[model samples]
Target: MILDKEILAGLIEGSPYPIYLILGEELRVALANAATLKAWGKDASVIGKRFLEALPEIDGQPFEALLRQVMRTGEAYYAVNDRADLMIDGQLKTFYYTFSYQPVKDADHQVIGVVCYATDVTQLVESASNISRMGLEAVENNERLAAINEALAASNEELATTNEELTESTRLLELSEGRFRSLIQQAPFAICVIRANDLVVTELNDRYLELVGKERTQLDGKPIWDGVPEAAEVYAPVMEKVFQSGEAFFAKEAELTLIRNGLAEQVFVDFVYEPVSDLSGNVSAVMVVGIDVSEKVRTRHAVEEVEERIRLAVEAAEIGTYDLNYKTGELVGSARFDEIFGLGNGVNRETIIDHYHPDDVHLSVLAHEEARKTGRIFYEARYIPKGLPLKWLRFQAKVYFDANGNRLRTLGTVMDITVYKALQQQKDDFISIASHELKTPLTTLKASLQLLVRMRENPNTVLFPKVIDQASRSMDKITELVDDLLNVSKINQGHVGLKKNWFNLSDMLEKCCIHVRESGSHELILEGDKSLMVYADEHRIDQVVVNLVNNAVKYAPDSREIFLGIKSLGEMVKVSVRDNGPGIPADKLPHLFDRYFRADERGTQVSGLGLGLFICADIVQRHGGEIGVESEPGQGSNFYFTLPLGEKEE
Candidate 1:
């Protein structure tokens, strides 16, 4: 039968032991029983508060750390006779308790919360201490009575009186011894006693037996090594020193390798071996007390390993990380963050902000405002670092807040995305240019067709031929644009094929610009290397020359003369196209040959998809040649390419 949450809560409320349930990494107190509330010296007001908020005094204590460790590792932690300093009645008081923090799992066996069960053992711990003191007193009293009995043995009356007194003292001593033994047996932590002479296990509690993975029967009258031989080598010397010098030995979080359940395992413990003396003041035995802390040690190691891995991954990716304090305006950043901004360490927010492009500063402000509302920060903007070109950076962060709804700090990462941004801008420009270029030709064709239909009806022979020619030119323009796009696609797909043949370079250059010359808008002057021959694809080389001449005509429209020159440089022939119009800007010249890059610096609309120069460069490079352009803002532009001169194979 499945129980409802209310029923389960009711059961916990009636439990004698203190019980509470905390949820999530924040340890929000989901439910607490009356016993728990009373033990914590708190009221019902702390029901929905975080564990630390309800009991703020426990902030620096191990309880919170242990609870968090249980949540992270999904492993339960148990502590016996643990000390806790708490606020009670407007004063800090210390208390001892035996408690456990068990992970609360969901249906899928995933840890979702922690359930703590505690039993206050303050009175028991105090009582055990008092009993130990009384036992020591009883031993001294017994020794004193032994001397008194020996002196009274010479007189019958005194001897009889001393014998009766001795009987009473003997009974009291036996009672104290019984109480001491019971206290040791009932103690929450492990305890054992071994003789100094033989190192035999004279006395031990159930907890000690369980700790060493042994039964009481096997170790009752045997040496400690007989039951657990693996620990003898590590602990024997320490025990011997305590016995010889009558000094106690203590170890905190010491690791020991022991064979338990037929398997060797590592164990961590906080323990002490105290020397016990006899009536003669000589060390008679050693009392050992220990508490296992292996789980805490393992949990800490696991957390460190995870953090180290994350640090390595961040360093490998060169991701810049930062933490900003909202209230104090304090900024802490990684080395990569400084590297991204071209600044040294100890840079502040203002110094970093100074590097952002002025136009994009408003973007970051708007993003931060939105982050305060939505708890997330994301924006992309331009940044100009010292002595470096403009770059695009993507910023992402998460805003944090306190439980009282006050804004805390923000943790974030930044990445350089200049290449991605350039590619994206190119894609957008290509789409816009392609749409306009294709539409103009399509609209003209539609108009020409309509005119032709009307002319056919009217039987005007002169206008009919002109309308047909116009439509045919429009179709050719559309076909050329489509071919340019297909060529770019084929190049990107690595499927562009080349057919090489020995051809005259000067002859190809002359016929390449026949269409440009027919327009009468410019003069195509051919010069240099008239007889130079190149072993390459003749058609492709012609396409390169045509593209360069067309580019000069479209960009340098006012210039009438376009010089196409060739030079014979020993084994290679060079082809050049020079325009007398305004040259390209220095900044734009770098991106002139880039895909979808147009040298329209004046913002004037130009036809074509800006694929001509990119295609030319690709074709020339494929044929084992070089291509380049040299131009300044005011000087006329000069574009050139070179191809190896080859001889025909016999």
Candidate 2:
């Protein structure tokens, strides 16, 4: 069954267990259920702040490091009976808890956040501590009895009085022993005592029997190894060492294999073995105390595996990561971050900021200011590296705040987007230009049709021809624009086919300029080799010549003469179209043939889709040829292309 976000949120909010979600490396508190909020002694106001900021008392604790570890490694952390100091009701109080930090992953299996599950165990810990104190009191009673025995041996006259006192003391000692045994049996953790001489189980609590998966009858008077033989190899030596040296041995999160429930299983435990001494000061037995930590140990192992995968993924993507300190202005970043900003190792925050374009720096500052409230920052701006072209970089980060609402730090990623920005600008320009170009011709066509309709009603023969001509020209303009659009689409789809054949280049060039010659404004001067033969598409070549000549006619209207030249050079033949019009600027020349680019000077308007030259370049490249232009202002311009000289067909 699927549940909506609202239902899921309600479930979390209504849950009795404390739950919260922290996002990003900064550990900003993205969500906190009611139980969690109450435990934290906070309200909804702390939702967008950094976890540490909302609970500043956790500064010296391991929570921040553990959360970050989960975030970095995609691992989960679990602890049982962990101690934490928190500010509750304006008082600093110590609390014990059983909690887990589970890594939250996105669809890509990347760790994006951490969800915390916690249970307060302070009362349970306090109850266990009281039981431990009672056991200590019983040990003290035994010592007192031993001293009393020495006092009686020193004075015979005091024996009778001492006997009375001894009777009362024995009674009290017996009572204390009973309470101690009762507390030990009901203890939350496992406890057992092994005799040092025979390594036999002299005494054990029910908790120990349950922990080892054994019956009281089987282990009560048996050797320690006889009940759980699988553990002898791993733990027997540790127990022996403690007894022989009369020193306590402590083991935390130690793995041990034991036979439980007729099966061998691995379990993790935090345990201690302390030597118990007799009245003569000789070690008589070894007392063992332990708690099962198998769940926590296994959880950490799973988290480590996830962390390995996440590390590999981050490296493969070459993503830049960074962590910034808001107060100190200190920055720590991955190698990719340094490469993106063109900075050296150990780069400071100020040095990196210097690379931001002066005009765009305000954008970053404003984004950060806004993030203080929103808990996130995202902005794209220009970056100018020393002696490098300007670049567009997208900066995304999450803001963190301290408990008092003061900015703490920000964690974020950066990516270079210069190419994407350029493409976006081109797309916008195409939309604007396409709208204007299409509208102009369509408007004229509509006006001409309206005029023709009126002329037909009035029956004016003189205006009829003019109206018909105007309509025809408008239709031709619209058709040209549509054809350019179709060609661009075809080129992008790689559907521009070529039909190759051997033909005389000069013969095609001559017929290609007929339309220009018919204009009667510009003269076509043909020059160079007239018999240069090449194997290529005849019609496509004709299209190239026509486009170049049309460009000269439209851009170089003042130039009365247009020259077409052809030359044979080794295995290739070159075709040139030269005009004595105003030349293109150096900066504009580089992008003259780019799609949707026009070379019209300021205040000068030109007609055409700006795609004629782009199409020409593509056609020439398909024929295994190169195209380029040369020009200077007022010195006119020369556009040329070269085709491979294939062997002539028989």
Candidate 3:
């Protein structure tokens, strides 16, 4: 909308409000509004001229950019008390002004020129003039009536100036309030303004509505207490206390449980209720600020529950569990685990893992690596007890992680599997004996039936003798089965009685060797003492030796050598049977003496029912001695037992 120059000049002169332009660009004036321009000394002539042409000093300033922005956007830019140096009517001046930059737009919304508005506030900067005149004017008093008139005039002028300052101050205060409201609305925290008398909410920020789980329409003009009962209940008394005492009230760890999305969730808050005061120092209202701590509260509760469950599970399962912080090298072990490992002194992340069974150390390292890489760990193995020989335990572990999937720590349990080991051995023994005993008799019976069939098919009565021979063989096999059953029964009943008597170890070994030689497949060699006396059940010791030698011949038929040795120590006689055969695997060596365990894969068909070694161990232990074996796969095996020797022989 373009306007003619004549019409624009008319509007500029007719406008009732004061307007001035002082920018880097175009400005105009028609017949100056006030002629008090010389009040600024030499810049008096500049009032009736264009601002940019009258003040050429700021030509290199950013005023040009400011002018363009206002002209193109038709938006005014304002600043209070801008400090700048200016040349007015060729006189230098230090000035401050309340000012604005505005666009003089044509009819088509095109910028014709830039206009600036400025109100000089330089009177505040001229206070030196008033202070210098104060005392000198008091000393030049003339007639009393004249002086009184002068004083009254001065007082009236002072009142007029004060009123003008107050009006300007009020406008500045309103501007400040507007800025404060903008900042509050943009804040992340909920803000509210309430009336002190009725506790009514007059205004609230957007976040305040979200926090209350309601919309502004639902909450506006409502009693603050009615709209947010939980917050109201907490702050009502607190606000009263703050108002009564004219002090702030603080509440920490205040918890509020609210239903969110149909689920109950707890929020922890820390807040302050501060009484707001009016100009007269009277409490008018209260302001509350709160911080939510719900996530921290929930995390602490979850950790507690997890730790508790871990403790109980480990205790009840007769296991020990541990946790280690990799960063700190700090270790924590459950009480049950400490008791089991006898490491009650406590253990940590760097707890000497070498103290565990040597064979299990590598497994532990592997599990640790897996946990570090994958953020999860799982492992189980047996370890010998720290202070006890032949006592072992099984341990298992898991690794926990952070939300980002980083490994946080390890959790594990240890169980006492010693009894389990013993029970497993007994089961193996029973199965081995049962399979062998049943299979041998069945094989003999089948052989006998085959012989009879042959006899029936042949036209020779002579074949009947061979059938009878097969029947006798079957009967012999059945008798052996019956003997094995009786022996197992006696051992179970603790009735395998030993006739305690002085016996020559050599004589006993010689008899055992003779019986073993009856099989005729292997050679037996005697070693060590020729004559040694042992005080034991002579018959039981003889049985033990015979079994060992027989086992050697049966298990190692391809080998020809067996070594039988008896050595007299201070109070015991040591006996051993050594054979050259495929040695036991390391894993199975510990279980060699377990019942039903055969050294080979054909366990079900192995002879002797896997019980002879177990029985030997039991009898030797009963005689106040020990028995053990040492072997490795593909290597020969050696079985050794010790028995108390007669004092005279020792």
Candidate 4:
């Protein structure tokens, strides 16, 4: 009868094993299962094909003899140490078998075909070999009969110890098994098991499932290579080598090309394929464990690019970069150093040294020589261009060395400061020139005026008072110019300071008004806060008020009235000089207090330097107050300032 279930009758409708076996034999029937038969390296269709034909290499000799013995004797036999040679994939392989064979007799007690049951015993044989190597050793007792008799007592003690050891070993084995399972299941990296025979996935952990983007149930019986094509392509060759050689292999920063969201991204993986061996030391499968390192790779690459860009930028800016070899008295420079020094863009040891000014070259040479002895080099010097003016450069350097304690080189940066240096020199020269040229005339004029004053009392002098008065006025004008210049210079140098003393704001304002009225043609009016006491510099504040009033009298000469007022604003004092004269033009108001600025086209006739308001501003600032002006063309101008009162001094 056909053993195929669909073609069988009602009696064949039980479990498929019995319907196919038709005999009381478990292994024989299980061996007939097509799926199980495939594991033995036979074609799946060998379920119906005769076993002899499927395994021709092992069909004769011991296998055939065992089958005949079971059939003719009508007996059952079991053997776990069976060995045979079989052809698999056209290669001869030695295989071990665990099988039981029984005779199937007809109703008349006649034997039919043999029932063969089997399982692969290759793994068990290797385990047995390992057990033999680790088995308890024996010692021969060859002493006297008395020692032999004492062996009986020792036997009982040894047996008890052996029992205790067996119990401990069992406990240890349980613990080790638990740890093994935990390690496989809780690994941070993906872990997967592949069948060595078929290259198919047999089991996978949650991490592996997540890596594949699939459920375990869907991937359990599938080939690992089929799902992860990129992974397969990258590691399959190594995996093949691992399986064939039964060795473990690893890869670092292996690139895996994957497509996600219709875009391709490269992933780097640090992975290993360890051979999962049965006790025989033959690889049965590969255990793959991998960590994703794509982020690390990308980060390193980005950092390298940023560093490269910074290096290029420093070079392109023509910044003279340097590193000093302190121990060797050597200097290194970037490519731009040559061009900066007016050398022909070829950077070398000689080219860098040639950039130093001739006068400064000895200093640089000495500095490096000193650094060679002291292990340090840092300086700022001027380098004279070959055919041009000298240029200033600053060098910032540090020394570093390797682990061997040998001083290597100094790394440094340099910059050109020529323009700034030139401007500073020009400023100093101007100050010196102004002092000599301007002060000389004032001294000569003062001396002449003094001699003229001495001749004023002579009998022959007619217009002596008028001449003296004109000379005094001229001296006054020159003194004002000198004072303004000194005041501005002090302010620029951050040296302007208040010389404070107890004074009345009202009295100071009146004094300033008296001076302005005496010196100008405009009529003056004084008003407000006669008792307002302020803590301030008496002379400087007097200068500010007088300067403002005088400026108003000069600029607004067309109007006759000028007003000087001092008042209390909160705890502070406000002093103002107001004029009812043709005021400052709106266009010139912004620059009214700028040094050496004149508000009108009419010059030399005004008979004063244009530094009155500038000095006024400086004096007010030094007193920790503010100065301001209000004006409209053809109307009037009011210049005012505020200072802290004595009550608000704190």
Candidate 5:
């Protein structure tokens, strides 16, 4: 396949089109004829130069790679109408060419060089492109016509089907009249037809006979004076009005005295007298549809007594109702509520909640969201109502859902609990004064009694020593109760200071649980993180733990095990006391931490004043933490409190 250098030079020189020969690894141009040099805007000075150097304008052209590929594989390459930017007459112009890269092989079948031949085809390529665009336009027009024809076919089919349905509707109308008669005979409510002109009974269904206490032999097709005289006088006028005005009459809570059980009993009803039309669209008869609502009326009236009692109590307490519209964020107040809140009738959620004490606003919002989830709300907070100074108000709401079953609104009452709060403050003050006054003398009495027992030879020698021992225990119980009261009073006065110091929460829990188990039949098991530490009032937190543990032992008598759990939760440390008792009821869970609220209906034989959890809640809340319980009827209970793991410097 090899060609001599001299022979290849003569062939290239004789070629009429642009052609060039390149050889070796460097791809230097072996020869370029007059046409090749002319097309490149160069002369014979480019001969024996690198193919790229001869025409540096085509530096990134595809021909270079194509030629190298053929020289390596010894296979010829052909490209048609390949684009190239060439410098012709010292000006760059775009050109298209059909070119070939042929391998020039030496002996032993090795490709030593590549010869390139090219022919310009810019005019032919442009003409074919124009024909392709015209073909595409014709295809698109055909497709549009095909779509229109398909739509026309669908329209024709719909018209034919519509005519068929019209004919079928006429036939079905005749059949529906017979079916309507059968349906009226089997209706559940009382249905009776009366003649509009004479106001006489025309037809009566079975339910109508049952309602009126008469049968077909006495009542059917009868005049007003012939059968039920009482019914005629009352229904005749209503029938006459419906027929004359062609309008239906609907009566809610209508009462009719009928003879039943040998006595005249008043029967309540919700009845509608609808005018029946003839073929000419004239009122021909009056059809009565009545539903018995006697039982519902009786039940409502009986419950009204209880509701009236509650209403009087609310009025006496100056409680008022309010509504929260979640969609518009508006707050609607009742007369008393408006007077207490002074927000008139048009306040918003943000504006009203903003009026709450800044520390308690977040808790109010949480209670609101909880109401939406559980459909119950009960919380107390301080509000700065306009025209009135800050007062304590108890917010209670019931959530209502929209048609789509989403929480739509919350309607509830707000009680002016300022007076109650003042009373509570006074009670706390009295307890604080009494506890402080009693503790001093009680301490002196305990010391004097102990010294007397020591002066005797032995405690068993004197009968009074046993009495003193029992009295000491009684005094100890009283002292503990007084301490709790004092703590609560401190909390109420905002003086329950936290002596915060870093201490192990688990160790504190163990000590509290051990103290509770010392006098009880319960066993305490400490679990979870043993090394969890928190910065809080050690004595105050101990009181919270002891309160929860004592409550578990009191309520859970059947179960002997109580679990004390401590865990680190992000920046907060959690301490929980779980019990295996007969858990709390759902209705009583909300009031568990309220002051003086005992869940046991049988009274407080086991608990002192029901202020244990209340005191605990106050202490935990003062430390900027939360206390809660998770319980169900039979699943036992878990009461937990969380304290933030305060900042530390290492």
Candidate 6:
């Protein structure tokens, strides 16, 4: 009796092993079950395609040749552990499978086509592929012998012979499945197996090894954290949970530092730690499956930072933000925006139009319309609320669109320009007032001087010459004071210019002492090393020394003696002026250098705008130097400053 093809197919299809049927001599795959199709990561579309065509990733591999050889020679071929690089998720990866190719013969005892039976052994062989390539060609001695002996048997006697052959095939398939492993090991998803006890890596697929920048030899059987120290802190606690509790742990968009090419890099991943159990139902290992989303995470973070910076800029500028939904005719605003418009957060079409001043309503509508049509907004309008102050609001916005280019909404900013307007007006008014006030007084003084010159021939002119001289000196002092005020303004505006040149610090001190000595009974003394050179604005330093020495004389009139000293430090020089009078109080000393701050007047003979020390402080600071004072209640005070040494050094 000949076994029907349908019956043979039914027997093999019920087996769990991957099985495919080939037709005619071409070995075109006739049928492939769900298990075989899934292993290939293929679908029903591959049913009619040739086995080689279906798995183009396996081109140049030995499977095609082995299958054809089994058909050509009528001998069975078995692969113990084989490497088949297959395309998985667009990336070609190496996979190992243990399988067999057996010949199927026609009723005439001539080989027609071959049957392919496979068991995925990738996980088992990948861990130890370097061991050797174990491929063996074997013939089914028992099956062939039984086929020959039973060939001559009566048709009724052949049933038992067929039963014995079927039983042997089933036993072989079971042994193969048990010895090999799952093809899922070659999946694109990264998988790393860590032993439960030491949490050491016992096995990892190619994808996992590549993701972590590690070699199998370096990581297999090693502590998981030893290779990637960054993952230790992040994975330890969660892995412990999975191992001890036997519960799986999952994290989406988790970030951790990993070593890539010898540099620490941040990698974001979606991953899971699953507990794998042994035959005894005890959890033995933890498997890690991860997908790297580092690029996506970095892109998202960059966008978030840009958005945050925009938010901060708006806040710092005190600009208000708003979103206008054109479809819904609604306007929503941030808190500051609502404050600017003097309205509640529920801004709609009514408030957008009516909240503005009546005079600006027409201009606001025109701007809104233009923004909707052109996707850009640039306009300024007034916002006047009942019983509240009016403000000039500058409106700026841009429109956005949906994916289909449908008009979506507008995002805009509003800023109150009232203070800017007020300052501009004040600037204009000050110029007019100063010109009128100064010109009239100067003109009157000039006319008075001319009249005096004209009267110099009269007897009264002789008496008035001193008066004219005094008036001229008074005018010069007034002009100087005015220039000082202007200089103070320029310094406050951070526009003061310095003419820098090299000068000797000790010589400048001596000249300042000489000037003080000329007009006062107080003795002026200079000490310290001479010829100390410094890089600075020489005129500014001269001004600083003059102010310090004069202040010492004015504040300590009782102290006839003053000491001006200069010393050289490394790359720097120090200058100090010490005075001995009823010394400054501790509280008053701190404010002495502050602009317009006057010390105790009991001993101070100085009278001016009180900007001398303030200007000195500014001059020293601009040259990258320090200026301060040291004083006590009864002891005299010392005002000192230090300057960097110039390049010209003796």
lDDT of each: 0.82, 0.82, 0.63, 0.63, 0.73, 0.71
lDDT of 2 at 601: 31
Residue 523 alpha-carbon offset, candidate 2, angstroms: 2.5
lDDT of 6 by residue, 181-229 (tens): 2333555557787898887887677878778887777788889888777
CA error at residue 494 for candidate 4, angstroms: 1.4
Question: For model 1, how does the per-residue alpha-carbon lDDT over 7-71 read when each residue is reduced to its tens digit?
Answer: 45555777666878898777989788898889989998898688889999988999888888999
| Regions of candidate 5 where Cα sits further than 4 Å from its true position | 1-205, 218-254, 260-264, 268-317, 368-377, 385-389, 398-408, 450-650
Count of backbone collisions within predicted model 1: 0
For model 3, residues 442-506, the per-residue Cα lDDT tens digits are 78788878767766756457767777777776777677556666777888898887779877878
Off by over 4 Å in 2: 1-319, 339-366, 382-391, 401-407, 601-603, 647-650
Off by over 4 Å in 4: 1-459, 513-515, 601-609, 647-650
What global local distance difference test value does model 2 have? 0.82
In model 4, which residue pairs have backbone atoms overlapping below 3 Å? 324-410
Best by TM-score: 1
> What are the runs in model 6 whose C-alpha is more than 4 Å off?
1-185, 195-202, 221-241, 349-359, 369-374, 401-408, 441-481, 487-650
In candidate 4, what are the lDDT values of residues 95-180, reduced to their tens digit? Answer: 77555665655323566555554545465455434323332110111122224345545687666655555555555555554555
lDDT (Cα, 0-100) at 18 in candidate 2: 82
Candidate 5 structure, TM-score to reference: 0.33
If scored against the real structure, what TM-score would every candidate get? Answer: 0.55, 0.54, 0.40, 0.36, 0.33, 0.46
What's the candidate order when arranged by decreasing TM-score? 1, 2, 6, 3, 4, 5
Q: Is candidate 1 or candidate 3 better by TM-score?
A: 1
Inter-residue clash pairs, candidate 2: 53-403, 73-307
Ranking by lDDT: 1, 2, 5, 6, 4, 3
